[model samples]
Target: MIRIACLIVMMMAGMLRAEVDARPDARVAARDAAQRLDAAARQMDKATTAKDRVKALSETVHAYEDGLDAMRDGLRRATVQEQRISRELKAREIEISRLLGVLQSIGAAPAPATLLHPDGPVGTARAGMVLADIMPGVNSEAASLRAQFEEVTTLRLLQKSATETLQKGLVGAQEARTALSQAVADRTDLPRRFTADPVRTAILIASTETLEGFASGLSQITDAEGGAPLPDISHRQGTLPLPVQGQVLRRAGEADAAGIQRPGIVMATRPQALVTTPTAATIRYRGPLLDYGNVMILEPQTGLLLVLAGLDVVYGHAGEVLPAGAPVGLMAGDPALSGEILQETPAGMGIGSGNRRSETLYIEIRQDNTPVDPELWFETDKDD
Candidate 1:
């Protein structure tokens, strides 16, 4: 029975790990966020306008927010595990009563004699019957004791790690939030694009009935100011670079788990990976969109636009002429395998979390507001 129970625990543990293998690691997340803060600081140093400064600080704020959120979740999950262990310890105390009684009476002559009896027919038969009745209780008590010790140790370690992460996140978030506030307060150095009529653009975005209409409206607003230098990207067909390094999980028109088929490529990438432009492009719009997280729309030519979405942070704003390979943003992820589930499992994992997010990027190329296969313009050798 002891062996069987141990086997059950082992199987359960494996299943838990399997489901959470996609979880971002805590330490890795902390480290990645710290690195991102440095990058944002550098960008802030070079920012000449209020919009640019705000863009840099926005990255910092996003990194801090993600880190703080992950740390809080980790701490919360660890506390729940500690509570569960406490409950198990209490249950074990009740379960061991019979085993404890047997142990106390082991010094009695009959019990000891029967347990230590030689293998003769009569003695062996009597001993076997007594052992059968006692072994299960004894084995169960031992298994529970072993499991309790291990559980306590694991909980303690998890709590300690979470505490450290929380401390780091708190410090980072505070500093970044302060800097972001200061950056936003500066209105004297606002850029021309930021000074543009935002109400009309907002109205256009709000009134657009479809993505094509929205893109077309954006193009009207983004029309090159008569003499702005185009990036000459129209010639780079069937060989444009990938925006970020990742494995292609889905091609254009592939139906996803949500049953929505769209003209885009979905790529699974590592946590906090750097997202960049494949060619020099003009930032038409970069910000949050409904259900897409952070999205960036960049135009490399007059009628063509590249759309990249599902990021933790975006680095540029509208009207910025981004050079090829310029960093656009960073994706979500951490180095550790941590699960964030919206509902509780049988084992009580993710009992109080809000949602689970998968790190998959969606890329779409639009030619004059019409969706087209991105593979035709991207390097075939690169993640084809």
Candidate 2:
């Protein structure tokens, strides 16, 4: 019994003395994102061609987005973990105190006294066996408590240092956006399907009152239909990627704040988020349209039009044919300068419920000038 008690004491002491140097999984993820951002930045600096620079800058923007997301998620998880550990520790205070007292008493007693009980040798032998059986359980509990304490300390440290990481990620994202804009301006290798007839486009714009009318008259704005045949994407009908990284904010035919229903889906995205072409297609029209803000209309297939609106800066001309994953435009809003935006939660909510995504992108798919569900064509599943 004395030996068993000594074993438990040693196990607890060893656990308490052990330091937890390993970071939490969340913190590790954040660091990995940071490394990706650094790599993308270096790639941009070493790029030898305009194409390479644009690709590098796009990667840099994506890396920063991923990094900032990691930081927010890590901060939230740390806060929850710390709170849970604190609650468990506080709730088990009485039990822990009793266990500690019993251990102290056992250590204080002499070996001879412990071995010889008032009920004689048989009683002492039974006590020894019982102690031996319960030793493992006691050791397990001690180990758990020690781990919780270490985790609490680590979580607190992570929360305290998150600000610096978040700030750096924001700054890196802003720089990448600026560089990408310049690279896109200097790019001139993209193929053109046909030269746009500006006179007809201006006339059409002045006469049209609806998106349907504008789309129906798109052929009039193009000088000719002759160009290299676009690759057949009939087999990839349901597998195309979304133009931007975001979460579905509203589905097709969903009403807005003013109860006005639209035949398109809305996506919640991060500020200055890059919007790309899901497939190689001709730029039908790109500029300010009625009330949809700056829009980019893509003709991936004959009679099929994909409309993307709510962008701040639109790229490409009306006739330029862009390749898949090409930069089309960026979402509105400046990059956050601090971590305070990440920590801002809704009323009566905790830190984990907060988000920095403040921009929305509107998407629509039209077939033969008729609006269809955008989700039917674009993959809407996002990790966020």
Give the number of the best model, judged by TM-score: 2
lDDT of 1 by residue, 1-384 (tens): 324433434434433344235333434443454455455444444453455665565555555545545555555655565556566556656444544454555535475564555667777677577556655555554565666567667665665655555555555545554565565455244222322246666787778766567677885554335445565666778877787765688888889899989898888765555577888787777777656888888888877999998987777567766667766777776523223322345543333542233478899999877899999888745453
Whole-model Cα lDDT per candidate?
A: 0.62, 0.75
How displaced is residue 286 in candidate 2, in Å? Answer: 1.6
> If scored against the real structure, what TM-score would every candidate get?
0.48, 0.81
Q: Please, what are the lDDT tens digits per residue for candidate 2 over residues 62-135?
A: 76676677776766666665665677667758667766766677779998977786779898888888777766
Cα lDDT, model 1, residue 15: 33
What's the TM for model 1? Answer: 0.48
Model 1, backbone clash pairs (residues 3+ apart or across chains), number: 4
Model 1: how far residue 91 lies from native, Å: 7.3
| Quality of model 1 by C-alpha lDDT | 0.62
